[model samples]
Target: MHNLRRIRKHLGITQKALGDGIGCTQGNVYHYERGQTLLPEMAGRLIAYAARDFGLVLTYDHIYGSAQLPPVAMAEVVNRG
Candidate 1:
């Protein structure tokens, strides 16, 4: 089962807050939590790191279940902008 909602609630932050933390909208957070749209691995790691900056720890298991998160290349991401 997806656990973004659980983790967000535990951290006492709203969907909008988490979305802002990760540069997404509240709608995106809602869909991601409900499985309407899959949260990409890179984006998941970004969110995890953002949450960490806020003193919360999240992981692939917490966000993407038992599956492993694929490695992300910072170069490609930086070049996209």
Candidate 2:
């Protein structure tokens, strides 16, 4: 969980910043980063945006402690829109 937060911080983005990018609230970002909740779709969007926009390779292991988020493709599509 701490690692997750560290990654977000490493990106030089505040919770509010991230939320703004993803159409969420800062409190929601805090909850997700802190492991208080799991938002699979939003997490995938964030990872995809980070990778495509910021050159950050945030795999599922980094974001969700698993290597099985298939939402990357969907994220890409959404990003294009």
Candidate 3:
């Protein structure tokens, strides 16, 4: 299972909100959370959105369930940008 759902919930981002930020629909986000593989373009968009909109950085491992996220400070994320 992808960690999209967990990441979103961890950041307190609603599906609709995340979808909107990434230029997709809530249904698409729902499907992605449920196990659909995200296309490269969509994955890139999602990564960009997390950083730009929420000051959160995300990696492929976080999205694909290969690794767990460490506690990240917003200040560090913003500074990295």
Candidate 4:
């Protein structure tokens, strides 16, 4: 499971705000945060948009454990970008 809700909240952003920034709806954000949906590609986009638009940097280690899976690595690239 991903800690997207926790991390986004820790970054001081509401679900709606995160959704708005990522071109998705709040329900989609909820699904992502709750692990009901798995949008790995969108997750990368969201992470990048969060850092570039909201100045919130979320590393792969923050969301997933240090497993270094392909998706997690992409998330790292998004976080760094």
For each of the candidates, the C-alpha root-mean-square deviation to the true structure, in angstroms, is 9.7, 7.6, 4.5, 7.8
What shift in Å separates residue 2 of candidate 1 from its native position after superposition?
2.0
Q: For residues 1-81, could you state the per-residue lDDT of candidate 4 as single tens digits?
A: 777776665556678877887788899988887777545777687679757765556666656654332222344435433
Model 1 lDDT tens row, 1-77:
56677656655567877677778789988887786645576357546654454444456665657544343344433
Prediction-by-prediction clash tally:
0, 0, 0, 0
Segments of candidate 3 deviating more than 4 angstroms: 72-81
How well does model 2 score by local distance difference test?
0.65
TM-score winner: 3
lDDT of each: 0.60, 0.65, 0.77, 0.66
TM-score of each: 0.60, 0.66, 0.77, 0.66
For candidate 1, the C-alpha RMSD (Å) to the true structure equals: 9.7
List, residue by residue over 1-81, the lDDT tens digit for candidate 2. Answer: 424576566566677867777778899878877677656787678777677656667776877664433323444434434
Candidate 1 regions exceeding 4 Å error are 42-51, 66-81
Better of 1 and 3 by lDDT: 3
Best by lDDT: 3
After the best TM-score superposition of candidate 3, give how far the Cα of residue 42 lies from its true spot, in angstroms. Answer: 1.1
- Deviation from native of the Cα of residue 37 in model 2, angstroms: 1.9
Candidate 4 lDDT at 78 equals: 52
